[model samples]
Target: MDPRDWLARNTFHHSAFQDLRRLVAEKERQGLRLSLCIPTLNEEKTIGKEIMLLRAELVSRYPLFDEIAVIDSGSSDRTREVAAAFGADVYESADILPETGTRRGKGENLWKAIYQLAGDIIVYLDADIKNIRPHFAYGLVGPLIERPEVRYVKAFYDRPLAGAGGTRPSGGGRVTEILIRPLFSLFFPDLAALIQPLSGEYAVRRETLERLSFPIGYGVETAHLMDVYRAHGLEAFAQTDLDRRVHRNQSTGDLGRMAFGILQTFLSRLRPGGGAEALPELHAMLRQFQARDNAYELVEHHIVEEERPPMIDLPAYRQRRGLPP
Candidate 1:
C-alpha cells in the first residue's frame, strides 16, 4: 500500500478512544488480559507519579489492565521502592530469569517483561515522562481492542522538551527526524507513516512481540517497527496521537551513540537472513569525540546492541505462557 494510504487508515487521535469504560468492557468481553510494563533506570523522580496515575485511573477505577509492572534495569534511586509503594509489581532485570543471564538497557527490561508479565497483550510506557496521563495507556489499548486485526499500536505525541522554566511544546524526536525517518523513506516507506517512530509508548500483542528479535538497547523501538512491518505488513500497525509528552532531553553526543546502535540494527536487516551473506558481527563499542579546552579527544562508548531471541523460542517462556513444550 502507498505510505499516504497507510497514514490515512492507521493514524488516530486519543480522543477517539475517550470511552475508557467501553474499552474496558470490550477487553473483558473478548477475554483478553492486558499488562502494563514500565522500564526504568534510576527514574525515581517520575516513576512514582506515573504508577500512581496509571494504577489509580486504569486499574482501580476502570480495571483496564490485569497487571501493572515495573521492570527495572538496576535503578540507583527510589524508583523501585516508590513504584512498589504505589502498588506496582516491581522486579529487577536480573531476577526475572537468572539462568539466561542479564544485560543493561531499556530493551532488556522490555524483553524480560514478556516472560514475567501475565497479560496476553502488553503495553510499554517509558518511566521518565513528566506529564504522563492515563491516555498513554488506554489510548494505545483502544485500537487493539476495537480492531481485532491490529496487532500493534504505537503512540505519537507532541513531545515537548522540558526546561527549567517550563516546556516548549516541540522538539523531542531528534533521532527519528534525522536517522530513522530518512532510513524509512529510503527503505520501508510504509512505516514512515509512524508519527513518532521511536516514541517509547506503545501497546503490542504478545504474539507479535514474541516472534520478533529485540535489540537490547537504544535500537529496540526502531527495530520493532521495522520487524513488525516485515512480518505482518502495514496493516498490522496502528498509531494514536497522545497530544503532548513532556520529558527531559538528551545531549547531541548521547543521541549520536543511540543512532550508532540503531544504524547497526537497521543495516543487519537489509539483506535476507540478517545479511549473513555479506555482514559480519557488529562491533559493540561506539566511538565518538569530545573537545577538551582546545584539543579534540576521542571517546569510545561500548554500545553493544545485543539482541534477545524471540520469547517464543525459549522453553521457560513457553512454560510460563502455558504453551506446548
Candidate 2:
C-alpha cells in the first residue's frame, strides 16, 4: 500500500482517546513508563499555568506520567521560579550535563532533558501554549503507549490562523506549510502526512530519541522527522489532531528569521551532488558593535548560507541502490 493510504488509516485525533483513565491503565498493563518535558525561554506568563495544570491533573492526580521536567534556556524572567513553584523539576539547560557546554535553543533544553529525566517514553510540550490542557500530553502520548508500532507521535493543532479565513482551517506556521512541507514532499514524500511538521509538541520512544542527533536549534523538529523517518520508515510516524494551541503571535521579522534558520538546515540536507534546484542567493548578515577601550567599533558579520548533501544522495547510498553516480 502507498504511504498516504497508510497514514489515512493509522493517523488519529486527540479525541479518539479522550479517556485518559483507560489510556493510563492500558499503559500500566504494558509496563510503559512516560515522561513530560517542557522546554522554556522567558515563558513566565504561561509557564506557571502549564506546569500547574499538567502536573496537578496528569501527574499528581492521574499518575499519567512518571516524571514532569522543565528544561529552560536561561530566561531573564521568573520562568524557572514559576515552573518550580508549580512543582515542576526545573533545570537550566546549561546546568544539565555541564560537560556538553550549554547553548540557547529549544533543542538544547530538550537534549539536556533526555539526560536529566528517566522514562521509556518522552512527550515534549511547548511552554508558550495558552490553551494548555491535559489532553496535550495524554493525546500525543496515548498513541505511542497504546501501539508499540507507533514510535513517534506528532501533535497537529486545529486552530484557524488569523486572516486565513478558514481556507487553512488546520493551520501551521508559514515555514511549515511553505518550506518544510514542499521540501519533504520532494524528498521524503512519506513524511508529508505530518500535518504540523514544525509543531513543538511530540512524543517519541526513548530508544529512538537516544540514537538520533538533535540539531540543538530550530532544525531540531525537521531533523527529528527526517532522522526518525530514515530509521523507522513511514509506519512509525503518527499525527494527532489537538484542538487549537493558543500562543504568542510572533512578529513577521521573528518569523522570517525562524524560516531562514529552518531553510538553511533543510537545504543543508538537500544539497550536495547538485541536489534539488539551485536556490536564489539568500543573505543573513548581522550588524554588531565591538567595544575597544572607551570607544566602540561597528562591525558586520556576513553569514553566507550554504548547504550540504542529503543522506539520500551519498555515493554509498547510490551504490547500494545500483544507481549510477
Candidate 3:
C-alpha cells in the first residue's frame, strides 16, 4: 500500500476510542485478554499515578485490561513498591526468566513481560510519563482489538517540553528526528509514515511480539519497526495520536549514546536475513567529549546492543505458553 493511503487509513485519534464500553465489548467478543506492562528503572513518583489511573479506569471501571503489571529493572528507588501499592502486579525483570539470566534495559523488561504476563495483547508504557492517563493504554489497544490485521499500534503525540522560557512543542525526540527518521526515509520509506517511531508506548499482539527478536537496549524500538515492516509491511501497523505526552528529556550526551546503539541496530538490519549475528564484530564503545572547567575530557560508554532471540524460539517460553516443542 502507498504510504499516504496507509496513513489515511491507519492513523487514528485517541478520542475515536474513548467509548470504553464499545471497545470492551469488541474485545470480549474477540475473546482477547489485554495486559499492560510498565517498564521502569527509577520512576517512583510517576509510576504510582500511572498505575492508579490506568487500573481504576481501564481495569476496575471498564475491565478493558485483564492485568496491569510493572516489570521493573531492579530499581533502587521505590518504583516497584509504589506500583504494588497502587494494585499493579509487580515483577522484577530478572526473576521472570532466571535461566536465561538478566540484562538491564527497558527492552529486557519488555521481552520478559511476554513470558510473564498472560494476555493475547500486551501494551507497553514507559514509567516516566507525568501526564499519566488510561487512554495511553486503551487507545493503543483499541486498534488491535478492533482490527485483526493490525498486529502493532504505535502511539504518536505532541511532546511538550518544559523549559526556563515556557513549554515548547517538539516532534518525536532528538534521537528520532536527527537519526532514526533520516535512516528510515532512506531505506524503510514505508515506516516513515509513523509519526513517533521511538515513542515508548505501543501495543503489540503476543503472537507477533514473540516472533520478533529483541535488542536489549535503546535499539529495540528501531529494530521492532524494521522487522515488523519487513515481515508484514506497513499494513500490519497502525498509529494513534495521543495529543500530548509530557516527560523528562534526555541530554545531548545521553542521546548520543542512544543514537550509537540505534545506529548499530539499523546497520545490522541492512544485511541479508537482517540479523545481528550476520554483522562483523563491531566496537561497542561510545566516546563523547565533556567540558569540565575550561577543559575537554573524553568519556567512554560501553553500549553493546546485545539481542535476545525470538521468544518463540525459547524452550521456556514455549513450555509456559503450552505450544508444541
Candidate 4:
C-alpha cells in the first residue's frame, strides 16, 4: 500500500471515536473484553492521577476498560501505594511470574501484563503522563473495537516536552528523531509512516500480542511494530492522532542510553530472518565517560535488553487462559 493511502485510511483523530456509548455498544456486540495496563517505575508523583483519571472515565463511567492494572518494576517510591489507593489492581513485576525469574524495565511490566490482566484486548500506557486524559485510552481502543481489520492501534501526537512550570510545544522523543526514524527511513520505509513509532500508548488484540516477543527495555515498542508489521502487514495496523502528549523529560545523556538499547533491537531485526536470535545476543553493559576535575573516567552501565517469549507458547499461560495444549 502507498504510504499516503495508508496514512489517510489507517490514521485517525480522537474526535472520530468521541461517542463513548457507540464504541461500547460495538465492543459488547463483538463480545470483546478490554484491559488497561499501565507499566510503571518510581512514578509516585503522577501515578495516582493517571490511575484515577483513567479508572474513573474508562472503567467506571464508560465501561470501556473492564479492569485497570498497574504492573510495576519494584519502585522504591509510593507508586504502587498511590496506584492501589486509586482503585487499580497493582502487581509487582517480581511477583507475576516468580518461577520464570524477573528483569527490570518498562517492557518487563508490559510483557507480564499479558499474563496478569484479564482483558482479551490489552491497552498498554505509560504511568508518568502528567496530562492523563480519556483520549489516551479511548483513542487507541476505539479503532480496534470499530474495525476488525485493525489488530493494533498505536498513539501518535504532538509531544510537548514537559518541565517544572510548563512545556515546550515540541522537542521530546530525542531518540526517535536522532536514531529510530532515520534508520526506519532507510530500511523500513513503510514503518517510517508511524509518527511516533516508539510511543508507549497502544491497544492490541490478545491474538496479535500472544504471537510476538517482548524486549525488556527501550526496544520493545519498536520491536513490536517491526514484528507485527512483518507477520500481519500494514493492513493490520492503525495509528491515532491524540492531539498532544505531555510527559516527563529526559536529558540527552539519558536519551543516549535509550538510543543504545533501541539500536540493538533494531539491528536484530535487520538480519535475514534474524529477528533477535539472528544476531548475536547484545551486551548489557554500555560504556560511557564521566568527566570530573577535567579528567575522564570510564563508567560501564548495564542496560540489558532481555526478551520474553510469546505468551501463547507458555504452558502455564495456556492453562490459565484455558487454551488447548
Candidate 5:
C-alpha cells in the first residue's frame, strides 16, 4: 500500500492518547530511556516556557524522560540562559565538537545533540514553539516507545499565522501546504502522507538516528523524512497532531530563501543520472552593500554541506549487517 494509505490506517493524533500517565507506564515496561532535544536560534522568549512545562509535567511530574536538553545554534539572545534557568541542559553546537567545526542552522544543533546526549530514544522539538506543552514531546515520543515496529514519529499541528496586523485564524506556512506538498505528491506520493513534513518536532530510535545523516540547515526535517522513508519504508513511520503552534511569522523573502535551500537539497537526492557526480560547492556568506558609516562591510561565514552518506551503504548498519557485500 502507498504511504497515504498507511498514514490513514496507522497515523494517530495526540488527542487519541491524552492519557500521558498510561504512556509513561508503557515506556517503563519497555525499558525505554527517553530524551528531549530542542534545537534553537534566538528563542529566548519561548524556550524558557517550553522547558519549564515539559520538565515539570514530563520529567518531574511523570518521570517520562531521562534528560531534557537544549542544543543551540549560537543564539546571542537569552535563549541559552533562559533554557538553563528553566533547568534544561543547554549546550552550544559549536562547543559540542570543536574539531568538526561549527555550521549555522537547526540541523547543526540536532546533529551535535545525537553525539552529546545519551538516550535510547531522542525526541527533537523546535525551540520557538510558543504554544508549548508536554504533549509536544510525549505525543511524538509515545508511539516509538510503545511499538517496536514504529521507528520514527513526526509532529503536525493546527498552525495560526501571525502578521503585522495580527493573527490569521486559519492559513499558515504558505510555502509548505501550497508548494512542498504538491511537489511531494507529484514525485514522492508516499512521502506526501507526512502531514507537516517540515514540522520541527519528532522522535526516533537511537539505532535509527545514529544511522541517518543530518542536513544542518532548513533542510534537516525534510531530509530526515526522506532519508528514513527510503531506508525503512512507510510502516516505520507515524505522525501526531499537536494542536496549534504560534510563533514569529516569516516574511515572503525569508520563506523564499528557505524554499530555495530545501529545493537544492531535495533535487540533489532525487536526480537519477548519477555516477560519482561532483558535489555542489556551497557558499555560505553573501556580500551586500549597506549604508553603514558610508562604507560597505564584508561579512565572513563558512557554509559547508556536511553530506550524510546513505545508511544502506554502511556495513555496520542494521539493515545491511548480515547482507553479503
Candidate 6:
C-alpha cells in the first residue's frame, strides 16, 4: 500500500476517541479485557500521578481497563510504593519470572507484564510522562478494540518545527529523526509512515505480542515495529496523535548509548534468520567522554541489547493463560 494511503486510513487523533462511554460500550461488546502496563525504573515523581489519573478515569469512572499494573525494574526510589499507594497493582520484574532470571531494562518489565497481567490487550505507557492524561491510554486502545484488523497502535506527539511558512508538526525526538526514521525509510519504507516510531507508548493485542521477541533495552521498541511489520505488514499497524507529551530530555551522551544499543538490534534483525543468533558477536561496550574538573574523562557503558523469547513459547505463560501446554 502507498504510505500516504496507509497514513490517511490508519492515523487518528486522541480527541476522536474521547467519548469514554462509547469506547467502553465497544470494549464490552467485543468481550475484550484491557490491561494498562506502566514500565518504570526510578519514576517516583511521575508514576503516582500517572496511576492516579489513569486508574480514576480508565478504571473507576469508565471501567475501560480491567487492571492497571506497574511493572517495576527494581528501583531504589519510592516508585513502587508510590504506584501501589495510588491503587496500581505493582510487581517487581524480577519476581514475576524468577526461573528465567532478570535483566534490568524497561523492556524486561514489559515482557514480564504479559505473564503477570490478565488483560487480553496490553497497553504500555512509560512512567516518566509529566503531563499524564487519560487519552494516552484510551486513544491507543481504541483502535485495537474497535478495529480487529489492527494488531498494534503506536502513539505520536506534536513536536512543532518552524518551516518556511510557519510551524508544523515534526516527528519524534533526536534519535528518531536522526536514526530510526532514516533507517526505516531506506529498508522498511512502509514503517517510515509511523510518525514517532520510537515513542514509548503503544497498545498491542496479546496474541500478537505473545508471538514476538522483545529486546530488553533501548532496542525493544525498534525491534517490535520491525518484527510486527515483517510478520503482519503495515496494514496491521495504526498510530494515534496524542497532541503533546512533556518529559525529561536525555543528554547527547545518553542518546549515543541508546543509539548504539538500537543499532545492534536493528542489524540483528537484518540477518536472514532474523534474531540474536543470526548476528555475529558484537562489542557491548560503549565508549564516551565526560568532563571532570574541566578535563575530559573516558567512560565506558556496557549496553547489551539482550532479548526475551515470545511469551507464547513459555510453558508457564501458556499455563497461566489457560492455554494447552
Largest lDDT belongs to which candidate? 6
Ten contiguous residues minimizing lDDT sum, candidate 4 = 163-172
Per-residue alpha-carbon lDDT of candidate 3 for residues 1-325, written as tens digits (9 for 90 to 100): 9999999999888878999999999999999999999999999989999999999999999999999999999999999999999999999998998999999899999999999999999999998899988888888998998889999999999632333676565468778888988988988888988889999999999999999999999999999999999889999999998878889989888899999999988887787654445678678898999899999999999988999999999999999999999
TM-score of every prediction relative to native: 0.93, 0.82, 0.94, 0.92, 0.81, 0.94
User: Model 5: which ten-residue window has the lowest total lDDT?
Assistant: 311-320
Each candidate: what lDDT? 0.89, 0.78, 0.91, 0.87, 0.77, 0.92
Per-residue lDDT for 1-325 in model 5, tens only?
6765787866777766668788889888988889999988888888899999999999999999999999988888999999999999989888876766777877777777777777889999887778888888888887887678989898888742233665554322677777778877876788887778887788989888877887777677777777788888888899887878787788865666677667666766675442325656445543333357978776433334455444344444433234455
Model 1: how large is the Cα RMSD against the reference? 4.0
Q: What clash pairs does model 2 have?
A: 271-309
Clashes of each: 0, 1, 0, 0, 0, 0
Error at 144, model 6, angstroms: 0.7
- Model 1 lDDT per residue over 31-89, tens place: 99999999999999999999999999999999999999999999888899999999999
Position 54, candidate 4: lDDT: 88
- What are the per-residue Cα lDDT tens digits for candidate 6 across 212-290? 9999999999999999999999999999989889999999999999999999899888876643465567788999998
Candidate 2, residue 314: how far the Cα is off, in Å:
26
Q: How close to the true structure is residue 247 of candidate 5, measured as C-alpha lDDT? A: 73
Over 18-50, each residue of candidate 2 has an lDDT whose tens digit, in order, gives 788898898899888899999998999999999
Those runs of model 3 whose alpha carbons end farther than 4 Å from true positions after fitting are 159-170, 273-281
- In model 5, which runs have C-alpha deviations exceeding 4 angstroms? 159-172, 272-325
Report model 3's TM-score to 2 decimal places. Answer: 0.94
Ranking by TM-score: 6, 3, 1, 4, 2, 5
